[model samples]
Target: MKKLDVTYSANIGSYLGVPIILEDNTMFGTLCAIDPSPHKFDKKDLELMQTLANFIANAIELGQAYEIILAEEQRVKKELELAKKVQTSVLSEPVQLEKINIQAYYQSSESLSGDMYSWFEISPNKFGVILIDVMGHGVSAALISMSIRSLLKGLITSISEPIEVIKELNHHIFSLFNSTHQSTYATAVYMVIDTELKTIEYVNAGHPSGLLFLDQKTMKRMDEGSIILGIFPNLKVDKQLIHYNEPSTIMLYTDGLTELINPVINDAIHTVENIIIGEPDNLQLIEEIKKEFVNGKTLKDDICLITVNVE
Candidate 1:
């Protein structure tokens, strides 16, 4: 203090003080006591003063740490809220086309999700559909999914071929997320449905095999495709074509739905086929499947389901 200068020392007869220092050796302030008359402080007096100073330093440090934690928590909460809003906006609603009905259901975990799904009508009876699941959760994964989302309509409409569209998407993903130390990737399935031709050309890139239901039974399993996107410099894509003369439904989903029933995706596809068998209405089928999913177990990850019902 300015009052503790040499000029003022003559007025203070006796004084003792200890600097309040934190664990990081940052000096906070001084703990001091002064007497008007001359006096001598003993060892006990000095020890007591030192203890009080230490206590004050610890309290101040703890209070500061608590405030910092609170601030960080608030910042993260706001960011997640913003991310969730952006995520919901990008996710498209279920659409009904000229020859096919497209239905989708999504469930988010505690935080943000990487699961994304959408379908765009290329023409009256032709549509391009896609479902993607990035590797992880939270802001990073959600951002990657959203970035891919922005490219969906353009890629689907322009390319119009499953293999070419997925290959292009893989190139984009690889270019965006490849780092020297780490890389991010996502599993995806892209389909071009031509109701006039009664054909569905699809490519599954390191994703769960899709289920195709016809005549109340599982007819085809979509297992063709290559590795996930964003990992390697080059990606190999295999497109599979299926013909459905009669009315049929195709189920495309992320890994979250499989995690509850079967860790194996093919097995999960078979299990869900049972639910879609009796329900002919695409909308009712979607609701029934959603009910089946939440019946007993809690969802561990984000679940996204897209069903294409060709009429």
Candidate 2:
């Protein structure tokens, strides 16, 4: 060993060092020892030093693994945030027209949701609205929901009929899953409203029945269609028509709204029916409904609601 300034100044006599090498043969540093006076380390001392070096190496490796884990967690969190933003951006905004007023509400149980909805004008006086709920929650379901949203945006442009649109979507989703060998499904309700004719044509694909409030004490349920999408390739869905003779309200929602824990499903539906029967303003009704599922009560799944008031 060279007599460096530090060694000479400190009167170091001997040194023992072992490289802290990882399992991948990457060197982190060195486990070293120095002496201030002339000394000789015996065979036993050398073996003990080697053992300590091994311990140090293991600790260092564990620390590095922990750092890697932390970095991966941060990356996943950021990706989830971005996904949530994209999902929220795709949701439909409230629609206010001369003949109808519509409002929608959505809430994700976690960082990402599987519920989605859209509303657009098909013709000059005709409007199309759709609500979809993927089978599960989280990133996978959110991605499926987004894919369906993109497909529907294109399908609605060409297919004006609700049943046809659902058929096309089901075919596409089923084909995609068949090729990928992954089984996934979604429930949806698609509706088309004609202002001049004062009629609504809709098809429900295994989703919860929509509530049509006829008057203060009267409400009609719309529950006509085939099974859920993505299960079968060639499926036929039936479309139901409602000809409104007077002012009315139509409520479309996901099962999450009525599938709460404290109140049973039937009771929750009754509660919502009561709220719709009493509340006149759609926005106020949404707020009240939200209150029912809040205050330390976590949602079991994503919640979505669409309210359309026909005048």
Candidate 3:
């Protein structure tokens, strides 16, 4: 008798009613009665065949499931990368103004960031600057920040007052997030400086208080607006007015700069002012501060600084 194992045999036997198998001990075909049918195999033999087929089917199904999971993961990763690039591009670069000198820097903590800063020339002399940080970081936060930027850009040309700019923006953000159960918020500081009048008007919305250096001797912290955007409906922020005459520097920044635990805010501010007082150049001032407090270290949070020298 020849060996007749399912693993070895490529063809089925003509006599299907009998169970044919080869024992491992010897290469001899053995026959056993699987179903009591004289004509052909019965339901019992058919069931055994179906059981084996099911095992192969299960293996194929598992392999397909694993492939689907891998593909979904890869798709999500690609989408995140694209979102990061779009968010970074939406934040404006160092824009040159005709009358005013502008030096600005933005460092994203992650591949995607919530922090956004934009400056646009409303006219030759009149310009608009916005510094904003969404509630969190990553894709969701980056999307919120991008939405805020779009809303601002559309409304900025029509709105002249900083408070009005914030009010309208707050309404748009809150309304958009209300239905989706997506509670998104932002902290922002906006300013419009009139170079001819030498007056700076700003509105702050739950962001870090900005710095106004008056001849290096007098330093005033500006904190005007009350609530964060998207928290309240029809939010109203008071616009604080400051007059900058002579050689004065207005420092608009995010909280990531001051919240450092090691150097501390007081020590950091001292280090920045010491270099900036004598050196009037905007580029030189930021370089000195970055070297001293930041130490060329990679930032954990997004850091944005906009220094405007009133000329």
TM-scores for the candidates: 0.82, 0.87, 0.71
lDDT of 1 by residue, 188-249 (tens): 98888888988888999999888788634556778788888888878878888887778888
Q: Write the per-residue lDDT of candidate 2 for residues 1-311, one digit (tens) a residue.
A: 56788779877878878777778888888888888766777888788887888888899889989999999999999999998998898787788877889999988899998899998888888888999999999988888888888887778867889989999989877886798788899899999988889899999999988888864346878789989999999888999988887778888999988886234766777777878888856787788777766546788888889998887
lDDT string, candidate 3, 1-311, tens digits: 23358513544443442222222333223233342222466688767765555564555567768999999989988987887777777766664445467787777777788888887766557777888888877777877787788877767767867989998878877887798887778888898877777778889999877777765457777678768988878786799888777767767777677664244766655545556566656777677667765676777777778887766
Determine the backbone clash count of candidate 3: 0
Better of 1 and 2 by TM-score: 2
Lowest lDDT block of 10, candidate 2: 260-269
Candidate 1 achieves a global lDDT of: 0.83
Comparison by lDDT, 2 against 3, better one: 2
Off by over 4 Å in 2: 1-16, 33-40, 261-263
Residue 280 alpha-carbon offset, candidate 2, angstroms = 3.6
